[model samples]
Target chain A: MFVTLWRMITFGFQNFFRNIWLSLITVLIVVLNLFLMSLVSGLNVVGQQTLTAVRQKVDLSVYFIPTTSEQRVDQIRQELLRKPEVQSIRLITRAEHLQELKKSAVDKGLVDAAIDALGDNPLGAGLVITSKTLDGYGAIANTLKDPKYQSIIEDTGNNFQTNQTVISRLSLIVNRVQVATLWLTLLFAVIAILMVFNTIRVAIYSQREEIGIMKLVGASDAFVRGPFVITSLLYGLVASILVTAVLVPILSLTNPFFAQFFAGYDINVLGYVREHLWTILGLEVAVGCGLSVISSLFAIGRYLRV
Target chain B: MVTFEHVTKTYQRRNVGLEDVSVNIEAGEFVSIVGQSGSGKTTFAKLIIAEEKADKGHITIGGWNITHIKHHEIPTLRRQIGVVFQDFKLLPKKTLFENVAFALEVAGERATRIKSVVPQVLKIVGLEQKMDRYPDQVSGGEQQRVVIARALVHRPKLLVADEPTGNLDSINAQEIIALLKKINEFGTTVVLVTHNREIVNMLHKRVITLDHGHVIADQQAGKYLL
Candidate 1:
């Protein structure tokens, strides 16, 4: 039985070389399928990273009027920080806020206008409140609206209004992308299944007579299917190599552009690939070969009726 | 050693491939089934291999009743009964040697057995020199000989040739018939199904003539009587 299995594997190898074009064509199809899937998968990785970084930069600020005393503002900051949902709150004084705006200003004209307006710094001390997740930032914003903290607000709490809108919009976009990626992966998976089915169907058609002859010569169904399964395995192996070769360099080159948004974040898709090297290759081979084997066996069993 | 008792094969409940066919052949005997295209000669061969099961009957081969043979056991029965079709059925991509070796490969014959058996069979069929040549490289007669070599790999007790020479010329047909006779002399039961009346008459073996799914004649030392 070992000898038979060895011969079957070797025969499959030889037959693959014998029909090089067909094997190559099938492998090419597999590569295209995997390439598209990997591209979508890689894009999803970048999308999540970008979304997280953007959300991290966003926070609601509760500012007091410039006339409000520093002792009261400090007390309000302490009270906000004590809330369970508030992960962190930073007290930004009027001078610090003015300096931050001036440092980040892209235009010198805006800085001059800000200093000249009202003959003094109109910017007020505020507390920049951040939550653990962007989704819960709105709740923290609503908590600041309580009648107890009404004195903490300056200018009817308009400071957090714009930030709240941005966070909600970002959250909606992220949710939509998640749904789209889910459906897209599902769609591609279906296409991959169909391609595997048709590929195996055509392969069986080519081997139809040979299958009958093998059966006539006393070859069991397992014996007949072993070669095709091995053939598909070779196809999967080649496809995985091709996809890896193409994806590694492309990801390495593009990850830096996306990393600029999030400090200390590296778009090292190659690193991810390296970390999961065997697993990724194994998954590709398993999916590609497993699909072909299942579809071919099913088709042969139904149509060949052997 | 094969017998078909009241075997009937109906396809789609309309076409009769084989109808209540009853026949028997003892061990080491040579039999020719002569018939027109649709006379069920091929179907009879298929029935023996259990490719087409009889609608109703007890069909036995070499003492095993195979009328209701399971799918898994069919291959074992097929291995015992070597069959050669008119199409040559040789893998086009493989050489004459590999084509012959495929049978041994499928049956898991040892390298020692394959190396020893393949060359010997090729020599018997006069294809020893052309073993390295592909099917396209060989003549029709040589291709048929390679297929014959393949059929003989198992050293089967029963050999069924369904128009083994249909694609070959008269000279090739004569060579094939001679080879069949030679194989029969080695104690293999040969069942030759053909329409070649000349080869049939020349064999002077037991002949079973069929017309429209009915066996009209079964003669020892039979001739082409149609």
Candidate 2:
């Protein structure tokens, strides 16, 4: 049995190499299918990683009323930090804000413009509220605008009209991208399956007479189907290696650019994408093997009657 | 020994294959079943191999009932009966040696057994010199000889050849008949199904003639009688 199986394996490889053009065509189709799946799945990973990092950068800045006493502002900061949603809070005084502005200015021209336009450093002391979770930021942002804080606070930066619209639109675009990628992945998966199905069907058609003759010569059913099964397995194995070899470098090349955009948060955006390497490979092989086996089995069962 | 009792086969539910066929051949007898097209000769050959099951009646080869044989059991049954078809049935991609050893491989014969039996059979078919050649590389007669060698590896009790020489020239046809006769001389029952009237006439062996699914004649030392 071992020798026969070994001979069958060798025969399968011999047949594959003997007809190089057909084998190349089959491998090309499988590679294209697996490549599309890997690309879609890989991009989805990066997109989600970027979105989560963006959400972690959210913070609410509560500016104190200009006339409020320093002690009153400090008392409001202490009260706000006690809230369950607040992960951390820091108070920025007007003088500190002016100092930060001067440090951010690249030249004397901007600093002189800022001093003349404002006349008297008009910036107020504000409380910066960082939330533990992005989902809870909206509720915390709303708390800063409550009537109870009207005596101590003037306005919250988180409630600015432009900032609200920009954040919501970015979230919306990310969600749309996710939905679109999912649909595209599903569509490409179906096409890949059909492509493999037709390839295997054509293979079985080409081998129909040979299989029939083998059956007539007292070859068992397993013996007759053995070569084709091994053929599919070889196709899947090769396609998976090709996909993984190509995808890893592609992911690595794009990681740095993605990382720079997500620098404000603690997340290693690229690390998340790289961690799923085995999963991507597993999915590719599973898809490749599954499509080939099912297609060949169904086609052979229908065509090879004997 | 092979026996077909009241065996009937229908193809496509309308076309007749074989109808109410009954016959018996003892061990070591070389019998020729003769018929023209649509006369159930090929159908009778397929029945014995369990390729097509009989609609009614029993088929016993070497005392094993094959009428209700399971699909999985067909392989073991086939291993016991050597079959040669009209097409020669040699795998075109395989060499002559691999073609003959394929039967033994399917039967799970040991590598040593295959290595031992294959060349011996090839020598018997007189294609030992051409064993390395492929089916396309060899002549039709040589390919048919390879198939006969493949059939003999099992040492089956019954050898059923359905027009084994249909595609060969007269010289090759005679050689094949002689080879079958020689095999019968060694005590293997041989059943040759053919439309070659001349070869059947010359054999002077037992003949079973079928016409439209019914046996028209059963005679010892039968001639090519229509």
Most accurate candidate by lDDT: 1
The residue ranges of model 2 lying beyond 4 angstroms of the native Cα positions read A1-8, A53-59, A65-96, A103-122, A125-136, A157-162, A248-279, A303-305
Cα lDDT tens digits for candidate 1, B159-220: 99999999999999999999999999999999999998999999989999998888999999
Q: What 10-residue stretch in candidate 1 chain B is worst by lDDT?
A: B10-19
lDDT of 1 at A116: 95
Q: How far off is model 1, as Cα RMSD?
A: 3.4
Distance from true location, Cα of A134 in model 2, Å: 6.1
Name the runs in model 1 displaced over 4 angstroms.
A64-98, A105-125, A153-156, A252-282
Q: In candidate 2, what are the lDDT values of residues B6-105, reduced to their tens digit?
A: 9889889588989888899899999999988999999999988888899998999999999999877887888888888778888877889988988888
